[model samples]
Target: MKGHTIGELRIGQSASFTKTISEHDVYTFAGVTGDLNPAHIDEVYAKGTQFRGRIAHGMLSAGLISAVIGMQLPGPGTIYVGQELSFRAPVRIGDTITATVTVEQLDPGRNRAVLRTVCTDQDGTCVVDGTTRIMPPKE
Candidate 1:
């Protein structure tokens, strides 16, 4: 998580971070986002939804992007400019999701970077795909 610097960034360079989604985590996220969709909070109700069981909120999985940019690649004090995302698959509780980001562009003068982001499950199933714009501190 250390030894990485802004200068190390390059187009196509990538990094990843993993998180295990738990039922508690799902409940907590639901509390925070007020997204108590039965598909995400109630097993029986979820069983009737298209997902067939409780699922984690898309944003909860997307939050992994923050772990990637703030703790791994551009690490600490990175400013988020914007992001674009598309949800591909439902993430269930207990799923270990890995979020990855690759530098798609870098602006040296501004210390900003454009990254392609992807979140996948242990089986390599994509849960979310997105792009982010960030500003990391200059060395």
Candidate 2:
């Protein structure tokens, strides 16, 4: 994968990645991050919550946005500078998510790009929305 240098990027450039959330994905993420929130791990407890069932960790879905920045739009060697995310919906096991990033602004002088990030489910529901700042590879 070849990454774009800051000078090579343009406003409105975009890329996406898709993956289906599996039960194992949720379990592994919870274990790795130590975020054993019942809403993510314990079905019985989750049944009592507003979600009424286990849901994938918000960050796990947000990571798909990071995947786009690091592996697709700017490709490899991208440096994440900042991100602001709003979780809009629950991601259940077996939900396929498509994460997309669009270049909203660019600062070649600073080698930075501002990207609009969004993740949608199979039904086209927006599950995660955010903006991120990244420094593309300096090539």
Candidate 3:
């Protein structure tokens, strides 16, 4: 995606992208965040948990929304100010999840935008929902 400016955005507009959840991503996120929870890394251990198999971390799936904003929309030099998230479903290895962001509100004076974000699996099941606040560069 190309870079964009704050003036380029319009309220109610949206952008979306998809990514496959891999075992490697889960393990790497565990290593990076030190969240070595069995549910995310151990299939055997996870089978005994409520998830019934290895599942990605809630934050890991949520992070895809950040990737969308930082790399796709309002990309490069965008400053994140806040986020609100709700985990709705478990993201399993091999699932193809799509992350979407819609411009909800824009504060032109502050160069900030409020976006409604969501991550959904291949079956159109919502895995995560949230709002993100970001200041896309003026120039």
In angstroms, give how far residue 58 of model 3 lies from its true place.
Answer: 1.0
The C-alpha lDDT values of all candidates are 0.88, 0.93, 0.89
Candidate 1, residue 80: the lDDT equals 86
- In model 2, which runs have C-alpha deviations exceeding 4 angstroms? none
RMSD of each: 1.8, 0.8, 1.3
Q: TM-score for every candidate vs. truth? A: 0.91, 0.97, 0.95
Q: Could you say which candidate leads in TM-score?
A: 2
Q: In candidate 2, how many Å is residue 112 off?
A: 0.6
**Tens digit of per-residue lDDT, candidate 2, span 1-139:** 7899988888999999999999999999988999998899899999999988999999999999989888888989999999999999999999999999999999988889999999999999999999999999997
Candidates, ranked, lDDT: 2, 3, 1
Model 3 regions more than 4 Å off: none
Instruction: Give the deviation of candidate 2 from the true structure as CA RMSD.
Output: 0.8
lDDT of 2: 0.93
- Candidate 3: tens digits of C-alpha lDDT, residues 85-126: 999999999999999999999988888889999999999999
